[model samples]
Target: MRQTGAVDPTLPPGWPAAVRPPGAPDWEHTAVAWLFDLVPPDYRAHEVLRRYPVLLARFARDHVAAGLEAARAGWRTVRVELADDLPADAMEAAITAYEREGARLASAARGVEAVAGALRGERWVPRL
Candidate 1:
């Protein structure tokens, strides 16, 4: 099992020392620790052990999709800030792409939760 508080020793090239990825609460630790609170002790020990790889893979994919959405949103904001100089068609396209990617991330996150719940013998009730 991947330790929640374990840091990734290797950093990507050109990554700033002080800069961390968006939604990363702590650069020195994996987000697994945060998830510990969501599961029962017994479930955490076993369910996480069994389902961690799937959960982590889904999480990574969702994180990447979210990052792409954020980048698109940031670019849109920058363009808007530049006195509406950005092309309207391009801006709309970017917004649509962001929404689609955001939806994908949302779906992935829900999938992770559902899998966790199933592993812990809890019923997964999707909202809508």
Candidate 2:
């Protein structure tokens, strides 16, 4: 069993540094803030999200997953879709941008999943 106060080195990549380990005090508040960042600014206007964080985490997860998928699709077709409008160099840059955004969205997706699990009272345990 892990100590309550120990830093969790086993947290998966993309876990927000701002959120304390599960079972720590006020971790959910920090998680809500981080989760809000992943979603659209308009989401902040919803009082329900503030009142119910687990629901917010679900929304964030869906939003980030969709973004990742869109980035992948964009990267795959940007060249052919925009070839007539963009110069060769510009097309290369667009592809690079899509690649970078896809990576970022992928990381956000992982982070949101971890946060959602934590919000649902799940704890990570280390195995020998």
Evaluated against the true structure, the overall lDDT of model 2 is 0.84
Candidate 1 similarity to native, TM-score: 0.39
Span of ten consecutive residues with least summed lDDT in model 2: 1-10
Q: Write the per-residue lDDT of candidate 2 for residues 85-122, one digit (tens) a residue.
A: 99999998998999999988987888888888878877
Clashing pairs in 1: none
TM-score of 2: 0.87
lDDT of 1 at 113: 50
**Which 10 consecutive positions of candidate 1 have the poorest summed lDDT?**
10-19
How does each model score on TM-score? 0.39, 0.87
lDDT tens readout by residue for model 1, 1-128: 32433433442222222324323555223334433323345645565443564464344445545665675676567556744665878777766776776664554455345443433445433343
C-alpha local distance difference test of each model: 0.46, 0.84
Model 1, runs deviating above 4 Å:
1-78, 81-85, 125-128
Stretches of candidate 2 above 4 Å error? 1-10
